[model samples]
Target: MSQPKHATPEQARPFLEAFKFFYQINDASANFFMRNTYPISIKKGTMLHKAGDICNHIYFITKGAVRGYVNDNGKEKITWISVENEMVTSIYSYYMQQPSLENMDAIEDCEILSMSHEKLNELYNLEPSVNILVRRILEKYYADAEVRALTSRFSDADTKYEFFLNTYSHLANRIPLTYIASFLGINLETLSRVRAKKRSIKKS
Candidate 1:
């Protein structure tokens, strides 16, 4: 993959906004966070972090999308997709300071602001509010992971597809059907049939 381009401060507003919104921090706090951050723009297909790599930073997407997946016996199983204004990180690797089992890659040309784990730790100690924000973010991440796990185990194929559509409506037409199928734990042919059936029902 080609090296990521450097992003200018003017191109970083959305990232700052997202950070403030997600963390519920004030402008001053957000500015402080941004000051310690770096910006990078990656092309589609760029791997942000591969399996077994330590995720040293958390990324705030200003543009484009990212997907997280794990390879299972040569099959790629997608676990999550994040789009513009969202954050992406390997939670286990970031928090535990260990190698990750998941791989994260850019699905579209992406501009992101990133903060290193070391900077995060410094902020946590310097600002009590940051500590609270981090706690809340972790809670949300855990809750979301639990929901995905339970849904995959209990939901039928159609139900899973429906949930995926609702969850990633913005990406329904943007990402490849194959990736979507993998994420929903269905084969490509099944996904095609499901889409055809839906289209037929709507046409009828």
Candidate 2:
């Protein structure tokens, strides 16, 4: 693992802006968070955290993208992909303080700001507003997870693909098709066929 460098307020601004947009955190609280964060740069294909590793931090992507996946019987099953201005972490491991079941890696060279579990917890205790922000952030993550789970369970392949496109349109051209196929619970051939069909329909 590379050493984490301290983030300057300028580098932390985008992360704070994201929180402010979602949680309405004030400048003072945001500055507190900025002061506590560390900056890290990861190259494409670098695994930030792997299965069986403890997830001690949550990362905010200042730039680039990251994906979460699990190795299932020699196949990589992608769970989620997050891009710039988004947060990524093995929530199960971070919250439970156990070894992670998922692997998180950079899909593109990334600039990230990270906050440790210890500092996050301390912020929760030291700042009442921080607790509200944390709760809302967790709720948002939970809601998104639940929706994705339900969609995968009930939606057809074409419908799933459509949902994937709609939900991750920004990432469509950025991430590999194989990862997107796995995320949508479809095979690569099927995804290709679906794209071909859509293209033909558009031309007609």
Q: Which pairs of residues collide in model 2? A: none
Residue-by-residue lDDT tens digits, candidate 1, 1-204 = 975544455766776555555577766666667577778889999999999999999998888989999999999999988888778899999999999999999989998888889988988777778787778767777887886776577456777777777766887899999888887888999889889888998899
The best candidate by TM-score is: 2
* Weakest ten-residue segment in model 1 by summed lDDT: 3-12
lDDT of each: 0.82, 0.86
What's the C-alpha lDDT at position 180 in model 1? 89
Model 2 regions lying over 4 Å from their true place: 1-4
By TM-score, how accurate is candidate 2?
0.94
- Please write out the lDDT profile of model 2 over residues 81-180, one tens digit for every residue: 8898888899989999999999999988999988999989988777788888888888898998986786588457888877777877887777889988
> What are the TM-scores, per candidate, against the unseen true structure?
0.89, 0.94
